[model samples]
Target: MSRKIREGLLMLISIVLLATGGTILYRQLLPSSAVKADGAKSGGQLSVRHAPEPKADVQGRFPAQSVERYAFSQEGKDLFSLLVARYQDSIGLPQSAVLFPKDAQEIASSPTGLRHDIWQSAADIIARKAPENALFLSWWDDGQRIHYLSGKEAWLRKPSDKTFVGPVWKALQDSLPVASDEERARLAQMARWLTMDSEKALSEIAAHFGASRPVYLLVNNDLLLHLAEFTAYGGTSLSLDSKNIPAGNDLHGDIALVKRWAFEAGDGNYLAQKEGNYYRVWSTPDAKAKNTLLVRLLPFIDSLKKLPKGVSLVYQSHWGGFLSVYKIDNQPIH
Candidate 1:
């Protein structure tokens, strides 16, 4: 009731209020996960920020050469093209999606025989615009090695001699319901290589996997080896073979043979017989080729001294994809 008592009570209440406010402010400044909830839902409120999607430059696989230009030349450019069109137009089939039923069915019908052009087109598009974080699909390659590439690496694999393509036939069976005699024959052939040797299969397949991206570049062993060396040593530098070719155990089985084969193949720039340990500028009509080549050579120049006697070398240059070669210093020049 007294004025001094009234003033004293008001001051005490203000001090309590200040203490409460300060406690809240300190909690707010605490690191997330450190802050305790005051009877809030599941701990506390989560501050969410809708970040803009990463503006990454997407890349896709482009056909290095037309289907008609390679080994399947005589089939007529239209033959394989027509096949792709039929697969695309088929009912209950998928146009382009990883492990889609339609794609599986198409593989079932023609296990070792896919339209290369269509595959390349689909692959390129998928690389450029990745709709998902991961993609998985079983593929067949007859006895021929399947080659898939992405970013800086390439994979080569040959299916077992007896595995039939399962998904393809499953799709076909789903749509056709009743298989004609010819369809049955195709199905049988597709499943011929179904069972696999788990050990060898796993070991061989494991080499192709990459940490950053999934495998995409698929080709036969011959083509795969050719491309690997091309991409590995900056598009087949001239120096790779010239210096290291002589210092091997055997001519046929030595590193020299690898170099020779690479050169004999297309874009044999792996043997860069240049005077300096630097890459040369080079270009190709094929963007995939150019990119692979560039990434391969950028490392060799920096580590030239440590290069193995039997190893290949690709150097970097001012321009892209061009290569330079050097031999190991202690290699026996036989």
Candidate 2:
């Protein structure tokens, strides 16, 4: 695990986030000026007024209609509705059926679906460019995909007795529907690897997955929305506070109402939202939640200035910049 991975073909990452075409202005925030004393500080706690605008350039930039489409978009809604035509009893259509043309277009409009291109792109990289017999580790979902498409070995394929429940709450998430014992202890450890800070997380990943072959970690950008879902799994304190404002007659009033919620930017919190169903903002302004592995891996949505240590930005899809691959550095296997 500590030895250097046999030098494999490293596919340089193409910074093509704006592939859909739009002026991408990587904002340069005035460090101290990004926040101002607007008579907003209260009880030694910071308020939105202290930092009225987003402190960092977040990934959920209210996606423009013509650009990238997610499962939560209007188009995604229509595709998902069509995809779920048969499965009336439960949400098994996506699991059992093939991802036809609709899958490429984004059918699962819930918080978890992404354009198939990202996964396919990463798979292509591993299949065509990466070295043979290299080991890949990731959240089980993408890990299984990499193994299948790339023909590479992905660790922790399936966790048993696990079920997911997704809800729409003004960008906020609540407890999922009851299910049989959801034992995701190992998967929870993977989540922890993503949520842990750079230093510790790097060591942990190497210890658990490193070997003579190269170990690559595949991550999707959509996990930014999954912040709340895996808190219990990773045993982290970070929280994603969400709020959705349905387009209504009370435009101004609702707009003002939208501003009120668990939002505090000075604490290094960013806001993201879904404009299709609602003016839904995906926000989690936890002052202490900035430097997790999840945030650094997917800078497309979350607010991380740079990628974490002990990982190299090996590849990124040229089509839709929704997923990324990282080559883990050498570390002692504990």
TM-score of each: 0.17, 0.55
Cα lDDT tens digits, model 2, 1-334, are 2223211111111112211212111001101122112233333221121121221211211211111111222211222210111111122211111111223333223222244444555566678777776777776545545554555766644433332322111111111111223426667777777777756888887787657678887776556555555665654856545554564555444434444542443342333333344554444465346666776666423343346678877876643345667888932111
Model 1 TM-score on a 0 to 1 scale = 0.17
lDDT of 1 by residue, 124-181 (tens): 4444443233322222221111113121111111222122122222222222223345
Error of 1 at 53 (Å): 41
lDDT of each: 0.24, 0.44
- TM-score of candidate 2 versus the correct structure, residues matched by position: 0.55
Top-lDDT structure, candidate number: 2
